[model samples]
Target: MNAESSVGAQPTASAPKRFALPSPARRALLRAGLTGAAAVGVSTALGAASASATPTTTSRNRPGTPDEALRELAVGNRRWRTFRQRHPHESPAVRQSLTSGQEPFAVVLGCIDSRVPPELVFDQGLGDLMTVRSAGEVLDEAVLGSVAYGVLELDIPLVMVLGHQSCGAVKAAVAADESGESLPAHIQYIADRIAPNIDRTKEGDARVDATIDANVRAVRAALAAEPDLAAKIATGELAVVGARYELSDQRVHRLA
Candidate 1:
């Protein structure tokens, strides 16, 4: 299904305008100019590949707008939760097409939790998304720069900072903050990054869940404020969002 139809949720009145794809000229110029500006980083990200091997034809045509990308994700999530996944873009031709290069439509920054793999949760296929993972969906220089490469080089329309229900990283942070014990090594680093986003006033799983949402929001805000990503947002070429995956229901919910 096309992104326009896959929106199982109701679309906003102004949403149509937001989903409009950039013109061919605008898209090309955007690819050229932004690619040049971020050439070093993009080159670092794609060492041997020649730009994006993705042609603008056929069904593999990635979503062209933030809303459309979001809608497609929502639809894919629905398919996942319902056990109706189409499993799109896994074909041999699609695989061969991507051998040239990739042009992902969205950047999904998700937790390293085993239960919440973004591709399966979103029911997307190869080359459909640029997936980055860290504990608690935490951002490090490498993680953030990887996401930025997708946006600045690939002109990806959406960036989703995906948190999840019962996030273990956030739980560790909550427990560590409560017990006054430091997590060891890089685990401590993850907890430290997550701790500030938690509210120390609450207790138990409720606290951890709340902190999970908070971390997603904080990450979303941080990415939105990033200079290069923010430039794309200002021009209406990109959107940064927060979402949560529920382990029990096997559902992904966009955070309000």
Candidate 2:
């Protein structure tokens, strides 16, 4: 079993399509809230729009400007690096509140690596961030739809592609590309996703770190090319940034 096995055995070729839906009770509650709040001014109505939005697999914490959201994530990561995790509320009140809905501040499309959990790295509590994880941080139709929900339905301002150092998947891709090793179908799938970027970054002086950075850039580019995300970014409603976390430092550097 590799690092991604924990996220569910490399989503088999026949892996069932996952779907997300809000609890009926929660949907009712949110609908009620929206109806009540819509009577207010346009600004207030917009605020309630996010708060009362139906929960989906891609739920966000709240509405914020791109810079504000980025700052919040950066500050959270600082706490994590220093082992000063705020360990915020995961209380019954919080759970019950989200029972009605969520308003996450940012959307994180990241790798499924256990060490790079978004909530912990960002020091965000329950209902704080909309997170999507995949091996190598690769994307497909469903993942794009998930990101779209974050931007269109949830009004999240920032979409981050979180990569990490010592990424085993990246290492595997580098090995397979170099040695022409026949990887298992599952591992091969991940390798294929990351291989092109690895090749592009290589000058016959490739290293795992370089490959990992390349993977980050590739996924970031993929997100940028997403039509829904592109439109939101063009309109200033969202920003997609690449980030790589250093395991030793536990700090995430924003890729330029």
Candidate 3:
């Protein structure tokens, strides 16, 4: 009743009647703020994603050129020769990294001898090489296919035919050739493949070594003439090289 009596008088200011936006206007304002914040968040996330992706690409695609691949092998072999092998690319992180894909740089054709594993001789680690082995580095259709796959599909730039000192395969061939004794079973296949190369060498203490080198060169030449590999070599996109692993010094010497 006391308030109604003040109808003629101005009502108490009531804190100056605070102004308020309508409900729809407030909702619109809230939506605009959220949209701007979401856009900022998306931009930041994309920038971070791009920053993270680049290094992984570079790391996965390293040793891009043939010369670089050869140099890496040379440096790794030096470490092995000095007994300072870093034994790189074998950690858990490296294993996980390679789970995505492999980018081997070279294809190594070595002997089946346990003493001359190409990875150890080159001081390389997992995913560093595509290794194909046979008795005396012999090249048959299967071997050629493997080598060609590496060159043509994987884009491997180097193929090394690696022979070693005192190869038993070469010695068997030499013995069979000298004594006219036939090697039995599939062992004969190895001996036959190696026989012609040994026949080109002089009969002496160095005959086995000569034959080993000759076999390496022969395989290298064979690989070079492979139609698929030859095209790559002709374009200077690949190199076929012969090298020898010396058992005495644990050293690799490139053959001429």
Q: What is the TM-score of each candidate against the true structure?
A: 0.79, 0.74, 0.75
Task: Please name the candidate that would achieve the greatest TM-score relative to the true structure.
Answer: 1
Pairs that collide in candidate 1 are none
Of candidate 1, the 10-residue stretch with the lowest lDDT total is 10-19
Q: In model 2, where do residues sit more than 4 Å from their true spots? A: 1-52, 55-63, 199-206
Writing each residue's lDDT as its tens digit, candidate 1 over 1-256 gives: 2232222222221110111234557756766765455555656787633435344344465789988898889899999999999988899888766656676888999999999888899999988889999999988777876787687667788888899888889999999988999888889999988877897566777888888988887777777766666677877888887788888988887775
| TM-score for candidate 2, residues paired by index | 0.74
Predict model 1's lDDT versus the native.
0.77
Write candidate 3's Cα lDDT for 66-178 as tens digits.
Answer: 56766777788888888998877899887666544567888999999999987887788877888999988877767776676566656788888889998999998888888
lDDT of 3: 0.70
User: What is the alpha-carbon RMSD of candidate 3 to the true structure?
Assistant: 31.3
lDDT of 2 by residue, 6-114 (tens): 1101111221223343354764565566545643553474543333465533433444777778778888888988889977748777666664567788889888999
Clashing pairs in 3: none
Alpha carbon deviation, residue 114, candidate 2 (Å)? 1.3
